[model samples]
Every structure is written in C-alpha cells, then in structure tokens.
Target: PDILHQLVKGTFKDHLVEWVGKYLEQVHGKTGTKNILADIDQQIAAAPPFPGLWCFPDGHNFSQWTGDNSKALMKVYLSAIEGHIPDDVEHTFHAFLEFCYIVRQNVIMDQTLAELRDALAQFHQYQEIFRMTGVCFDFSLPHQHSMLHYDLLI
Candidate 1:
C-alpha cells in the first residue's frame, strides 16, 4: 500500500499533469499549460499520504484509478481553462487537494464504521459472559476514546 501510494503520488501524478497540460494546450492555447502543469505537479507531489487508518484494498481495480474522483479532478482542470472554474492554477490545484482530502476522510470514516460494527459483534458474542458475571470484561477505554476522536474528526 505504501509503495502504491508513492507510485500514485509520484508517477501517476506526473503523467496526469502532463495529460492535463496537453489537453489544456489543445483546447485552449499553449500559453499557460507549461506553468499550470508545473504547478500541478509540484502540488500533487507535495501533498501528504492518506491517513494510516485508511486501507486500500489489495487487488487490481481499474475504478480505483479511473473513478469519479479522477473525473472530477479533470473536470476542474478543464473548467478552469474554459473559465467556468477560477482560472488561477492554484484554484485548480486546490480542487485536487480537496478531492484528496475528501477521499481520505471517506476512507477513515468507512474504516471506523467497520471497526465499530466488529466491536458490536464481539459485544454480542460476550454478552452472555457479562450477564453471568454481572461485569463487562472489555475495557479498552483508550482505544474507544481514539475511535470517538476519529468519529468527531469525520
């Protein structure tokens, strides 16, 4: 996952920036594509990795590369060139940043929810024991609080 993230952050971003630059140059003029591409490449390369709790599934999934997130990023770049979105390169780059942030948040929330579900299942499994002893054995308070913090962050 770390290697995949690095590849996406480095090579994938580089290729996408080049592709978008060529697209803008063709649709609009070749006036600012170079600068825009450079800025986009720098921003993407500098962006932080996804949060640790977020797990990328292990397998080949084309949609992972070519999904609505990628489409929205392309749309934002095109819109900026066509004067629909703000034309500034920074504004277009911010769209990418926002997309990454959203993806990270969604991943974290999904993971947290899955964990909560598992915890509930375990609680159900141990309910009989608690009733017999009149006490709950599960006492991971710090872990529970961390999950609450994650919930609040989400």
Candidate 2:
C-alpha cells in the first residue's frame, strides 16, 4: 500500500508524463534514449491523462475487518502485501507501461492486442516474485533467460 502511494505520488504521475513526451518523439520519428529523454518535458505537461488504477479494489472485507488493541491481524496482512498491490492492477500497469515501452521501441511504434497481454504477464511475474520463499533468488540474468525458455504464452 505504501509503495502504491509512493508510486502514485512519485513515479506514475511523473513517468506517465515522461512517457507521453517519448510518444511525441516517436511520432516525430525520433530514435535513441537521448531523443526519448527529450520528451520528458512534454509528457509532464499533460497531467492525469491516463485511465484507472493499476491495482485491485480494496478487499471486500476492508471495512469489516478492524484491528483490535493488539492489531496483530492488521500487522500480518500489511506485512504480507509488502510493497505491491494485488496482481491484477500490477499487471495492468505493466501492460500499460510495456505498451509505452514497445511503442517507443521504434520510430513509429504501434500498440497491438498481443502487446497488452505481454505487459500484463510481465507485471504478473513481478508480483509472483514477492510470493516466493526459501529460494536462492537471482533476479538479473538467470531469471530472464529461464522465463524465455518456458513456453508460457504471455
């Protein structure tokens, strides 16, 4: 929840704007990271331009569940969530972010249905990582290579 809050205030608001600027650069047939960086200013100028939350609705029991003086249950649930929201929204945002990335990947990038699903899966794995336990975690190269090896259609 805190991560969500920080993202809302920090990255999401700013990144979306930066992404828009990149979009414009792509529209004008720009290339390279520096050219993409040029769009940051324009993207920031457009505020609240996107749609919907990138997380799930607060749980159905959110209101019904209240903490007692000990507040143990609240502590447990909060700890479990760590820094991420439910998989649904995370993946949605992943899709949205990926669409922005791939579109700008080319001088004249376009969005496709396949890309949308791929983005969702990208975020899904991101969320799944948090659920892992008792494993020697190496997030850099091995994970990326192994993910590709699986015939999982994302």
Candidate 3:
C-alpha cells in the first residue's frame, strides 16, 4: 500500500484524528464539563495561518478529506492535540509523526535508519493508550500493520 494514501490519509486520519475525537468525547462526557470536541475544533480552526501550511478553518470535521487535506492536517494535528490528551497518547502521535517525517526524506542514512526504528518502537509502546482508553478494542486493522514493513523497504 502507498504510504501517503494508506498510512497518511487513511489509517492516521481514521485512527488518530477520528478516534481521538471519540476518545476525548468519552473522557469528557462523564462530567459534562465542556464540549471537548468542539473546543478542539475551535482551537484547530484558530490556529494561525502561515505561508505554506494550510489552515484548518473547519478543523477535522469535514465530511471528506483530500490527500492534500490530510497532509496539511497532519502538520497541525500534534500541536492541536498536545495538551488536550494524555501524555502517552501525545507520545504515540509524536512518535508516529516523527516516523512519518523521517521516512519521507529522500536520503536515508544509517542515523535515519536507526531513528526510524526508534520512532516506530516508540509508536508501538505508547499506542496502547487507545485500547486502554477503550478507543480501540484491538489494533487489528490492516492499514495499521503496513508501517511495520518500512524497514523491509530499505
């Protein structure tokens, strides 16, 4: 499967973006303290505009996502989610995004290779936050497993 299409726009969008929303709702729904999802949407929409980065005025609420949209959202997602979620969940996303950016480089040196392994390892270590929070019962999804093949690709 193509990394950009399958992993970036597909699995990450569904699991991290959408499921994170669901997780936030589940966490905040108990006390009815505030609309955490809406807060997230607002915070994302209010993200300052920069030259090349796309501004998510509507946040991640769109009905459909183009490839470019997914890529752009990835740039802002970690920051938008930083303080709102648990540290482990943030670490999971950070590691995944780190792996994504690192693998995108055209030149993969020995250091980059080692970094890839570390990033993927960190991702696996923290991803249990999903199951722990009940956002996912299992990480059995097909697209999710494809990232494990990156080393073989080298």
Candidate 4:
C-alpha cells in the first residue's frame, strides 16, 4: 500500500502538472505551467492551520490527500491554474477521477481481468498523462511502474 500510495501521489502530481499545463498552454498560449503549479503548491503549503482546514479558491477544504475527494483536489488544482472556475471542466474532471477510482479499486481486488479492462479503457482519456510521462504502450523502461521508484527518489 505504501508503494502504491507513493506511486499514486508521484504519478498523479506529475500528471496534474502536465495536464494543467497543456490545457493552459492551449488556452492562453504558453503560460508558465511550472511556475503556476509551484506557486499554488507553495500557497497551499503556507496556509495557516486554523480549524484544520486548507481552503482553496473554489472553497474545498483539503484536509487529506487520499480519500473520496481526490477528484475534488484535481478540480481545485485546475481552478488554481486559471484562477477561475471552468464552466464545463467539472464533467471531464469527474470522469478522470472516476477512472482513477476504478484503477485503485481494481488493485484492491487482486488483479481481476474485468477491472484491468476498465482501467485500460479509461486510459484513453489520459493521452496527456501518457505522453507527458513518457509512458510507452508496453509500459517499458523510462515508462512503467518498474522505473518509477528510481526517478521518484531523485
């Protein structure tokens, strides 16, 4: 679970930054994705712990990273990117989150083929996740979970 947790956090953080970057760059034409994410992360990190709530711009309280509200975190992240609520991003964001939930649930189910298929199907929506992460079709070197640990520690 610890390894899986780390992979989830590491991979999704990278994915979050990349996906947000692509979306913003598409809309605003070469916005600084790295700077934006860094600023947002710093802002979130610097919040004063009062009432034990991490208040985002969209009003979601980010208390935990791993839970039912993981998708909400992604939405908050997207909101941070543009400093505005996206009109139609909610549905797409929810779909992505649902896919992540399915992946996590499948891992818990001990490698069932049905769950694997569902997870793979959802991957189609995440072309950016794959492209930005350099994940290959075969999930080989410089891709795949096998190489994640080495890079993550650095």
Q: Highest TM-score: which candidate?
A: 3
Residues 1-154, candidate 2, lDDT per residue (tens digit)? Answer: 1222223322333332233334334444456434434333223232232443121132212344222311222112222222323353345345435533443343332345356447646644553433252121343433233334222332
Clashing residue pair totals per candidate (backbone < 3 A): 0, 2, 0, 0
Model 3 — which ten-residue stretch has the worst lDDT? 30-39
Error of 3 at 73 (Å): 0.5
Model 1 lDDT on a 0 to 1 scale: 0.38
Q: Pick by lDDT: which candidate is best? A: 3
Clashing residue pairs in candidate 4 (N, C-alpha, C atoms within 3 angstroms): none
Candidate 2 clash total?
2
lDDT (Cα atoms) of all candidates against the true structure:
0.38, 0.34, 0.81, 0.43
* Candidate 1 least-lDDT 10 residues: 53-62
Task: Give the Cα error of residue 87 in candidate 4, in Å.
Answer: 12
The C-alpha TM-scores of every prediction are: 0.25, 0.22, 0.90, 0.40
Looking at candidate 3, what is the lDDT of residue 31? Answer: 44
Where is model 4 poorest over a 10-residue stretch in terms of lDDT?
145-154
Question: What tens digits encode model 1's per-residue C-alpha lDDT throughout 1-154?
Answer: 2212432333224433443444556545556655555554444343444543212222121244544334434333432334311233333344334333443543566765565445434433433332243232443434222322323445
lDDT per residue as tens, model 4, 1-154: 2434433454444444345556655554555644555666655544555653544543323465563344335534543444521433333344445444554552344344345445434444444343443332333322224322322232
CA lDDT for candidate 2: 0.34
